[model samples]
Target: MLPHCIGVYACGMGGAGMALATDATKIASNPALGGRLGNELSVSLGWMHPDRTMDAQGPTPPGFPFPFANTASGEQTSQIENYPDGALAFNYRLSPTLAVGAAMVPGGGGETKYAMSRTATGQMGFGNAGAMYDSQVRIRYASLTPTVAWTPSAKASYGASVILGYMDFKSNMAVMNPAFTGLPSSPTLMTSGANELERVYGIGLKVGGVWDLSPQVSVAATASTGTRYQRLDDYRDLFTGPLHLPPNFGVGVTFRASPSTDIVADVQYQMWEAVEAIGGEQPAQGGFGWENQPIFALGVQHRLSDRFAVRAGWNYGPSPIPDDVVFANALFPAVIEHHFTAGATYAISDRWEVSGSAYFAPKVTQTDPGTGDMFSQFGGGTVITMKQYGGQVGLRWKF
Candidate 1:
């Protein structure tokens, strides 16, 4: 899902903490920025709500073996899903010119549970477009980074982090169609036996920098190298290949608009097209047919008093899943495109603070007319849609 979420500060800013290093999130957003903050630690928990559904193609082969058209109009939803995306970070400044930082947190993930599906299957060679089936996919990724930042001048700084990534992916789908391709010889796709897929540890690196243009303005940039994930041993018959997390780059700027207000803006690019398993043009032959995605975000923070502060932000991006690939990607739909966010921070004391944020993205629906080679044989005119909203709360200690 690449929520692009990390610590509370980053989340409150709509993923715009790279240049505004005010909290512990600096350890994850820009290692170099961390040293500027004294020793600090934070923990956060989050929740998600999604209303999604998938419908069968409008046109199907006459006498299709399944009853997809009949049940395609229903809404399938998971009103709430609570996930743990907590972070703990520490920063140390060895000298006026050198600093170090470290953090552990969730990097990316998504979950989908589809209880509403058109599964009207018949005894045949394979399940028709309309078959009774239940399916779900949940992917989780975590990362630990230790960073070092060097400041050679009062106005410029640079840093790098060693990234250690851990990821787990699971998928389950079953169709009552007697014509299931995995019927007798390869029934693993239909049940729990060999359906689970996992990728243990993947490693990578990140580097970033911030430059002071003036007393109240700064520019920042960060880049991450891609991670090559291990293949799925249990589902070798399904993927037949390996999948990888793509690299990404971002640039941002921050301005101290007033004595109590700061404004931040950012542009980011994810090189998803570099990954073959899911970055191609189609989902068949074990590909997810995904495309590269770009993100734009902005945030404004204002201090009402020494003890109270509030912030709001906007994050936007194109859907990674295209309409042509909506069918196969139904289980992994990360298509929501527009998000509005708001939050506030309360200072419990000089050394303790509480931060919270909330965001909502309107639903995005992709419809595939089904002109590809596979659609003609299987089905056509399918539709997939996803809408999401979430919130988080964090407690921080700064020394």
Candidate 2:
């Protein structure tokens, strides 16, 4: 999953600032907060780096035609990638109690590239037909959200947004046919065969609200119907079903502990099982077998003085891939579950500010439940591990 918070303010707070209107970036998180900002603009840029590796040991069945010599015992490390992330947002008050806003930000996606060694016959144990082949997959998403918010009373604000999204996807990996028997009549080993980048467009909706419970407490919630895109004709035989983004819902609360200090907490749930290509049965169905996931975030911000503030936070979630499905998920090892973040903001003037934030996720590893049955598809002595680090810098202007 991609980092949900594209702006430095929210990233510094571990993505828990959705309930409060701190900056124009709120338009992407909870549009209701836009009404609270009279006029604001924000822009940010960042990079993400992930470290991933895979190790496997294979067994040659007594009666098999090709013994997959390259899979005997080997370890492959994924190449490091510095993926870029950025966002721009603006909010304008159309009336005393009405506001319009827009934001361009990343939705969610991942990338992986693994180098493999070929055998004497120009075929690898992984079943790729090319010599010295590398298994790789990259998927990216960008979204533009236009929102309208209304505040009829001092107690609450409501908003709605329309999401226009685009996706770029490509994959070059080996896949086994369900009925493979290593016999002459069995289906031959197949791969995606260096497909070109494919593009798709989709639309979705989001609605949210923020309510003040008292002078020092407030709560907010937001939900989105994930985008549905056109079919990837080039990948018809590579995947079980068309790929679609997953839906999500989140809630957050903010409390003022002191005049210069505030604390925030949030919970978000992703419905991966609702997507056909992501939550399908197994390898036979060409799905990832990913389970629904829930994430938690907590943050604290303290104003050191009139011109400076500091923030720190923590975020956590359980891995969505079950142990039984580890074999199939090797191509996408999104196993990191813990994140630690810190950041600071400096007000250069009454109407200008600069903010920066950084975060790191510790390494996590998972091993497959190897049963020596390759045809079962799930059993293989494969281990996958991943870790991540990233940071962002931004400038915000208020008019």
Would you list the C-alpha lDDT of every candidate in the order shown?
0.71, 0.77
TM-score of each candidate? 0.87, 0.92
Question: Residue 115, candidate 2: how far off, in angstroms?
Answer: 1.7
Per-residue lDDT over 119-214 for candidate 2, one digit per residue giving the tens place of the 0 to 100 score: 211134234434443356788888899999999989899998898989888876555545666554333244453547998888989899999999
**Where in model 2 is the C-alpha error above 4 Å?**
65-73, 117-134, 177-181, 184-193, 371-379
* Candidate 2: clashing pairs of residues: none
Q: lDDT by residue for model 1 over 1-399, one digit each (tens)?
A: 777557777777777757877776676777768645666777777776776776655454454543333244454554335565667777777888888878887777777766654222311212323333335677787888988888888888888998888888775543322234532332112423123666678788889889999989999999988666777665454453555678898999999999999999989898887887677645555566778999998889999999999988888899987777666676677888988888899999999999998888898988766765453224356677888788889888886
- Per-candidate clash tally: 11, 0
Candidate 1: worst-modelled 10 consecutive residues by lDDT:
119-128
Q: Which stretches of candidate 1 lie over 4 Å from their true place?
A: 61-75, 78-80, 116-134, 173-193, 197-199, 373-379
